[model samples]
Target: MAVVASLTDRKSVQPGIQSLVDLVSGGMEQVNQIILSKAGSNVELIPEIAKHLISSGGKRLRPMLTLACADMFGYQGDGHVTLAASVEFMHTATLLHDDVVDESDMRRGKLAARKLWGNQASVLVGDYLLGQAFKMMVDVGSLEALRILSEASAIIAEGEVMQLGAAKDIATTEAQYLKVIEAKTAALFAAAAEVGPVVAGESAEMKKAARSYGMELGLAFQLVDDALDYGGSSADLGKDVGDDFREGKITLPVVFAIQRGDDKDKAFWKRCLETDGIEDGDLDHAIELMSRYDAIADTVERARSYGDSALKALDRLPAGAHQTALAEAVAFCIARVS
Candidate 1:
């Protein structure tokens, strides 16, 4: 992954994004425990898989974004808690479904839900979580919240389907890839951030700004993640390098590498990516070709551009420490690949 640029002492309006992070640090435990407790039941496989995946640690960044956005809007209502958890459940549901779609065996350095509990179980449990998330949203009694999450979920599904079709298609373009990432990853982040303003009854403009910020941040984050999959440490990232390549998933780096490579290189990449499995040294060669073409730098540059855009979206929001932290986090997402 790219190294997050130095953010210490950086100027920011809302450092509350970071402060919110600190505030919500221990709060997620309660959410997770509650999920596990309530999920306990007749279906042993569901609990097993849910427990395994949930226990595998995550930063709970989605919920943090939701809470921070609410707080930034001066919301003091306790309903933010349920909204936060709902966002997390939505996130976790996507993870379960994503792993199944990707046929991924590992997540957070542990067995993925599909691997541990079987694909059928993983898919069903993912659905269950989505239902639970909606139920919580309904409990919050906000039509805006329902609209945000529902629209996001639809976008996410569309993105996933688009990506699935895009994979291994040598004709895939950079613009198309960006669209896929925007739908698959950024939509959820945008929803997570936007829903907070919705819950807090912030002005339409503020909600739009928050949504745009998160959408840009999510794009930056996923672009960097793709770059890292092509050239990153499994130990550092908690996921294997070349995962995108291994799965025949055509990410930005691969698209760039193909576009930049010579005819022979292009042909070779085509064969490797289309085949069921890549041969020894194909990954290394791909990496070398990507390097020669500066694919990583290309991805980084794009991520940085989006990071700047995300910070720009913050301009319309209320000034506070949390906003600064959110901006810093955006910078960190892009820099993390360095």
Candidate 2:
């Protein structure tokens, strides 16, 4: 497919996620309403910090998954909307916390919340978002959905801690890195999708399939993001290129490069990443080393593999517009590197 080829070939036009966006538009409107309503607080700073990130132009993909999965089963209820909003809050909370933890300056092409509000405010607002999310979950009154999301929250936290442990460690293996992303990123995707079926009263088999789709898709999504941190421009990536490298984040491409590098290359990684002794030519040299090893290409290849698995998981779901859009969504994610 042209979209698959687009993983490595920028000239090929990608099939975008617009289809999924269109399919879930109505449900997303409800989700937006809930999000805005719930984000409100008498504490001025709470709403200020919360709305700053909430109003920022994230794609709201996780909540969209919840809505689409529920709608796929021909569900007709407000519960899905509530759950979708909760998923979004959980995601927003994570981002708020992530920016602070990563010491990031930008998000979605704008100044990160931490930059504007400071770390203490950003973290507190993130906690507030989580509180609002849990309250909404209880409002939905689905113990199963609550269980899935609560567990995901805890898993995501563990993943964050895992990433901290692996950070700047050039010796980090591919297996170790995978464990980090699977928990930090894919856990929420799995929960967002599984809750749809749970709220819709679908069978366990279908819920399992949906969770598989989401988990695999999340992995693909994150892998592509890792690739883009090196391969893509800021305009396309919504953040400065090489941010991961600058932050000493150990990702798949970095893992591959470190494994394949010679002693000199290894020493360079140690200086730039482990010791944070970056010089003027360091970023360029780092990119060159990754290119020499074909690290970015290999990382994209891995993402395509996960994307393939995500597409297969979609096949087990009910057939409809949602399935097609969701499948295309997988392709769209991987194609971002192009």
Candidate 3:
């Protein structure tokens, strides 16, 4: 709770980013309430499972992007708040299911939903959250919004599926890896950013700009996430290091390493994924391979490129405190380690 309250107090953020943070903070309260109410009183079990992930302090970046995108388009209607919350619910639902699928133990610095509630409860509550999310979107009464959200959800599912299949496959290329990230990670970001412009009735060009900004930023975000999995401080990242390797999940860093790795390193990389439950030393070895290939540095540069492209997408937004904040926010995508 203190974390949530303190997000707005980061002095390093520009005013525009602060405004978006404030709007997102206001919108998330309604979204949480809506989720609990929709789960019903009798199903206290399910609500508790949902709350495990919901109450954990995520940055609420997706919903914040939605609100900021809406704000950029001069939207004053309250409908955006409902939609913003809806987007967050959709995101949380995915996280719940992802924890179950990945058999993950930690999220947001605590036990995962599946760990506390069991897989059955976690999966069911995840389903409930998805249903409630769509209903909230319906309450907003925009077919356009529905279509965008539905497409995003579908793409996200595809991305998950693609990643699942790619897991344990040594041949998974960087291009295929990028595709998976685009679907699983970038799709929701693009949709969240685009929703505001569509609802506010902005020009097609501006809507496209919003979409571009989000897609590029989202890509950068995921790349950084992969990089952090290998090199970041566990306390800062809120998850154990090398979870990706432990899960045998093929991310950009690994793919790049495999592509660029030397013969001895390549063979070692191959063996690492082939074995179940990576040894602690294997993580150090993996990092070494990535470092030698310069994959981590390359990944960071790629993230920076996307962050730059995200800033470019906002070129048309009128000069104001809000637009400046949005630009700073896009940069923060690469800056934040967590």
The candidate maximizing TM-score is 2
Put down candidate 1 lDDT per residue, 93-161, tens digits, no spaces: 889999999999789887787876788899998888888888888888999899999999999999999
User: What order do candidates take by TM-score, descending?
Assistant: 2, 1, 3
Counted clashes in each candidate structure:
22, 0, 2
Off by over 4 Å in 2: 1-14
Candidate 3 per-residue lDDT over residues 126-218, each given as its tens digit: 888788889988999989989999899999999999999988888998899999999999999999988888888888887788888789889
- Candidate 3: minimum summed lDDT over ten consecutive residues — where? 1-10
lDDT value, candidate 3, whole model: 0.79
* Candidate 1 wrongly placed segments (more than 4 Å): 1-20, 26-30
How does residue 314 of candidate 2 score in lDDT? Answer: 80
lDDT of each: 0.81, 0.90, 0.79
- lDDT tens per residue, model 2, 1-338: 11222223434324578988999899899899888999998899998888888887888999999999999999999899999999999999999999999999999889998999899999999999999999999999999999999999999999999999999999999999999999999999999999989999999999998999999999999999998888889987778999999999999999999999999999999999999898998888988998999999999999988888887778889877788788778878877874
The TM-score that candidate 1 achieves is 0.92
- lDDT measured at residue 226 in model 3 versus the true structure, 0 to 100: 88
Q: Per-residue lDDT for 289 in model 1?
A: 91
Better of 2 and 3 by lDDT: 2
